[model samples]
Target: MASGKWKKRIRRAKGGHELEQAAALPYRFENGHLKIMLVTSRSTHRFTLPKGWPMKKRSLADAARIEALEEAGIEGKVSRSTIGHYLYWKRLKRVFIPVKVRVYPLHVQCENARWPEQKQRQRKWLSPDEAGLLVDEPQLMSFIASLDTDHRA
Candidate 1:
C-alpha cells in the first residue's frame, strides 16, 4: 500500500482526534538471526505487537516497554526513540476509536514464565517476515519488515 493511502486511512478512521498509544517490538538475536516476539490481542486473539494507551508519568517508549512486560511477559532495553508509527482502530464499547501507535524497539533480555495477562494472551517468536505476514496492519507490517536493518525515527 502507498504511504499516503495509509495516512488517509488513518485520517478517515479517526474523524475526531486520534488517540496516542505506544507499542513495543520485542526482539532478540538468535543464532545470528533476528527474532521478534509477538503477542495475541486478548479481545480478538489476533497476532499483534504488545501495545496500549499512554501511561501517566511514563514516556511513550517506557510505556511501550511496560506494555510488553504486562502483555508478553518479556523485558529488556527499550529505545527512547520511536522507530516508526502505524494507525489502527481500537474497538471500544460501541465505537472504534482511531489510535496512532508509536513503536519503540525493545531488546529482549528475559521472558518470564509468569506475568500479568499471561493467561489472557499468547506470545510467539517469529522471524521479521513471518511477523509481518501475521499482523493485519500494513504500516505495522512495514515496521516488522525493517527489523533486519537499523532504522531510526
Candidate 2:
C-alpha cells in the first residue's frame, strides 16, 4: 500500500517521531478458515501484533520475521512486500510517542512449543474481524479488516 494513505499528524520533541520499522501480522489456515495471531503487550496486556524496532544488518521483512519469533514464537515465510503501514501511540516514561510501523504478512508454517517471550505474552488465534475488535488502534484494526481480501501478501 502507498505510504501516503497512512500519513498522519506526528507530534515530536527535540528529535522526531519514532518508527517501529517492522511488524508481522501472523496468520494460518485453520480448517479452511484464516486465523490471525494476536499477542498481549508486555506492559499493558493489550492485544497487538508481533513487532519491534529495526535490527542491525537485517531487512525490514527479516526483522519482522525475527520479531515474530521473539514476540509471538511463530515463524514462517514473510511477505517480501509490505501489506500496509499504521500509526500508533507507544507509551513512554512521561509521554506517548507516535510510532509508524510497516506491516508484513507472515504465512505461518509452524508454531514452536517453546520460544523466546513464551511466558511474557499470551497469544490468541482469531478471525480477522475478531482480531480487529481486540486491537485498540483504529488504523491497525482497519489494516486487519483489509487483510480479509488483501492479496498482496
Best by TM-score: 1
- Candidate 2 per-residue lDDT, tens place, 1-153, comes to 234423432234226745566999998887777889999999999999999877789999999999999998898999989988998877655566678899999999989989899899999999998999999888889878877777333
Cα lDDT tens digits, model 1, 65-144, are 99999999999999999988999877654567778899999999999999999999999999888998899999998888
lDDT of 1: 0.87
What does candidate 1 score on TM? Answer: 0.87
RMSD of each: 7.4, 6.8
Give lDDT for model 2: 0.84
After TM-score superposition, what is the CA distance of residue 133 in candidate 1 from its true location, in Å? 0.6
- Model 1, 22: alpha-carbon shift in Å? 0.4
| Cα distance off (Å), candidate 2, residue 56 | 0.8
Candidate 1: stretches off by over 4 Å: 1-15, 151-153
Clashing pairs in 2: none
